[model samples]
Target: MVDILEKLTIVVKRGKADKNSPYPPDLKGQDGADELTAEALKMGFTPDEVLQKALVKGMHLIGEDFSAGRAFVPEMLMAAKAMKAAMKHIEPFFKSGSVKQKGTVIMGTVQGDLHDIGKNLVAMMIEGAGWKVVDLGSDTSFEKFLAALEEYPDAIVGMSALLTTTMVNMKGITEKIKEVSPKTIVMVGGAPLSQDFCTQIGADFYSPDPQGATEYLDALVKSA
Candidate 1:
């Protein structure tokens, strides 16, 4: 049973979606995350257990590698794909209340920014870390973010901006969120953003990498 779970983790980390997936070369023809996840469930592992012990563990490894420069965007995207394949099997459990999420994260690429690669990566990382992510997609406005907040009152907000021009919008978004929900946490990220800029914008946190964002949210859940 443990071996099955371990295989699931390896497939995810190696970016294998299923037996049909030939990604990463070496693992071709072997069952990937999709199959392994189902196998774990069939072997009587609870959804929560499989999530924490296998899926999340694999994503954590990939996240760390990404942060260390050992992994690149392509690898991270592949890993996220594998994780997504596995997640499909467990999502029903989450909706049925058999598994609980750590928190809700409302994410978007701030208005005037059409970039979504960075935003998507962070959303995947956060979702793998056990949080429910509601992605607002690119070119998101302040009103869209606020609407999401109103729906999920306790949710955290994550904003991304790949362009220096669009990054300025984060300041206004953060201010508006605070106006409505001062206690809500707002995290900002993207290439043009710095810790200094984050502070200036009044955002609660800033991380250069997806792993840092995941860790920050995890700490928040633990502290709460």
Candidate 2:
């Protein structure tokens, strides 16, 4: 049983979606995350157990690899794909409220910024780390963010801006959110963003990569 779980973790970390996936040449024709996750469920492993023990464990390792330059975008995307495939089976448990998430997180690309790769990656990584993510999508406005916050008042807000021009707009959005909900935690990041800029804009956190973002949020949730 432990071996099966370990296999599932490896499949997820290496981006193996299923037996037919050939991207990772070394693991050809072997059962991947999809099959392993399903098999785990069949063997009486609870969905939450599979998620916490296998998926999250795998994702955390993959995330660290990405942060350290040991992995690239293609590898990370593959891992993301594998994670998504497994998540399809686990989502029902979440809906049933049996898999309680740490907290809700509202995330989006800032207004005038249509770029979404980084934003999406952060959202996916956060969700895989056991938080319920409410993705507001690209080119999101302050009003839309406010609406989401109103719906999930306890949610931490994350904003991304890949362009330097759009990065300037983050301050306005941050101010608007703070005006209404001073207690709301705001995190900012993107290619053009820096820790100094994050502090200047009153954003509580800034991450250079998805793993950092996930780690920051995890710490916050665990402390709460």
Best-fitting candidate, scored by lDDT: 1
Q: What lDDT score belongs to each candidate, Candidate 1 first?
A: 0.94, 0.91
lDDT of 1 at 64: 94
Please report how far candidate 2 places residue 58 from its true position, in Å: 0.6
Quote model 1's TM-score. 0.99
TM-score per model over all chains: 0.99, 0.97
Writing each residue's lDDT as its tens digit, candidate 1 over 112-214 gives 9999999999999999899999999999999999999989999999999999999999999899889989999999999999999999999999999999999
Off by over 4 Å in 1: none
Which residue runs does candidate 2 get wrong by more than 4 Å?
none
Model 2 agreement with the true structure over 136-169: per-residue lDDT tens digits: 9999999999999999999999999999989998
Overlapping backbone residue pairs in candidate 2 total 0
What is the alpha-carbon lDDT of model 2 when measured against the actual structure? 0.91
